[model samples]
Target: MLSQPPVWFILIAFIAALGPLVFFHELGHYVVARVFGVGAESFSIGFGREVAGWTDKRGTRWKVGWLPLGGYVKFVGDLNPVSMPGEEKEDLSVEQRRRAFHCRPVWQRFLIVLAGPAANFLLAILIFATFYVAYGRPETPAVIGPVIANSAADHAGLKAGDRIISINGSATRYFQDIQAVTSLRPNYSVDLVYERGSQLRRVPVRLGSEQRLDEFGQKYVVGLLGVRPPQLVYKRLSVFEAVPAACGATANVTKMMVEIIGQIVTGERSPKELGGPLRMAQVAGQRASLGWSDFVYLIALFSINLGFINLLPVPMLDGGHLALYTVEAVQRRPVSLRAQEWAFRSGLAFLLALLIFTTLNDLGSFGLWESVGRLIG
Candidate 1:
């Protein structure tokens, strides 16, 4: 048997990551629809068979589903999970038709459609803000802890304990900021502002190309400056301090995601970096073993990711609906139903293929596929 992580960790992480995240995502649609007087028939977490359920005062069925990967909300007069289903046009009671989604004003409908992704983003900000407010901010010292021998810093005479204050004349408040700048390119030169003894000094470092293996065992060449940041120390924050701190965290995460995506698009990063359910299960198992704090952090990060992914402008996603709404606002007409149908079908197929590919990657990364191959061999 492979050395797999515990089952309980896997279960908890999966539930925490997908359960509330998906629920809130769908709930965004539900709440906004209700606000616009659209009657939501059901707000469900997951797919397939229904498990536990309750009826709300508004007569909405809130239920848990068997499949735990995602969820959806069904609204009155909506033919599909999304609001774009094509059904036979039927005459409705005035009361019933009045509460239908299509009867709302364009702006109102747009807001309802936009709310799902907005909720996800809001959740991420809130989680990050809460963490920052509760524990203040944990940061590594800007002083260099170690310099790799023969690395870029070594050649530039950069030594351990040197405190970095800026890069290329730009002030850096965090060690991560320095590391990000260093990863630009091979043979690139960056001016470092640092404190040596009692004197502030500036030095130029030429980054060198080095091959590094990621967690997936895929090797890629990246520029390295070879200075390490010291361990994190918790800093206290005042009531006024938490908001900006949280905003900073959100901005940092957004920047990192943008960089990673840019690297991927430019072929500087590998496609194998994409992961799916298996990767999540593996991470959950590992984080669970670390402790509750680590697990919670992982959950928060994944929740942010969940929010980000839904905002991509793909048909069948919340962003796609927003895009359509924006176009409608500009042109003063809805897009053709035929166009939407084809687009949604294409998007669904693409997403399914992506899921399959990511699942395979995850299994390979976890050594599950390798072990199976060995057994067959």
Candidate 2:
């Protein structure tokens, strides 16, 4: 039986994983702010009241807060939590006004805002590359492990121990390739070429349906072929092969992210798929139990997600700041305060609603709702 993780362990793992990511993200903004000659008042890792802190030679107060959810960098002459507020122009004294974020040139502001997301992407790439080199590449030969009786693959005459050669005449080197192709283009009959007893044979299989959970409480049906592919094993590679392997891993992860986004857009995935700190902790704990390398991979993936999210053009995010800067560059003036306020308000509301939905989703995922239903039933 698989061992279940303790809640405390999950919480600890969440903090450990999120802390450095948050720090690096905020530090990216701070570094670019300094480069742009923007005076930063304080840099905080986490939110709410400060716990432990120290002042740097640059007069930036670096502090850790009680809440480990997220962090921020406070630039001089910023009125609101977001340094991009409209009244930041009028809120400070003449001397302080000179140090205001809005006072900076548009290009400088753009770079400052762009740095955070850029840093996250860079971190993800580095972490992924490092892990790849350290653990060797994982590879799965295109071999069949199992075929469920009377299922698609079995009906198509696919047998255990058969080596898959191609799908629709396209050569497949790895089992993952076949799985990927099947996952994306489900419900269609696939022409599979396989090797059995030294003979190559072609088989046509119709994908069958399986129940899957999405963002809404509704269960959806997905097509499955009832074929289990061989597992990926760690295969040590030469230095040259390691580099390509790392690049391939990164590319694969990027493709997965794009697919996930597309699925959400198509309503094939739920908006409630979004997760907060609670979900992060659960995943972190599960990965931690898997082993150090698995945990590191999870961190790299999460870091990439952080990078991708920060680049979204939503108000109060790094990308949102960049969007505003782009408009100011073109218009030669900032958007009016009323417009900024309304945008921020709407963004905040949207974020809150998303948070509530995701939190509910997380609870449901943990079987909380199901357990409650069982008790009542």
Worst 10 residues of 1 by lDDT: 84-93
**Residue 97 miss distance in model 1 (angstroms):** 3.5
Candidate 1, residues 1-377, lDDT tens digits: the string is 13456777677777776788887788888888877789987888988899999998988898999889888888777778777843433666687677887666779988887788777766777776677677767676678888989998899898888988987765667776676666655566878788989989988878888877644344556678888876766776765787677667766676667767786788877777888987787677666666777777777677668767777788888778778778878999877888878878888888899899988887777678889999999
Scored against the true structure, residue 110 in model 1 reaches a CA lDDT of: 82
Model 2 weakest 10-residue run by lDDT? 213-222
lDDT of 2 by residue, 247-354 (tens): 666666666688778878888767766676678788888788777877878888888788777778888677777887889899999878778778778778877877
Q: List the residue pairs that clash in candidate 2.
A: none
lDDT for each of the candidates? 0.77, 0.77
Who wins the TM-score comparison? Answer: 1
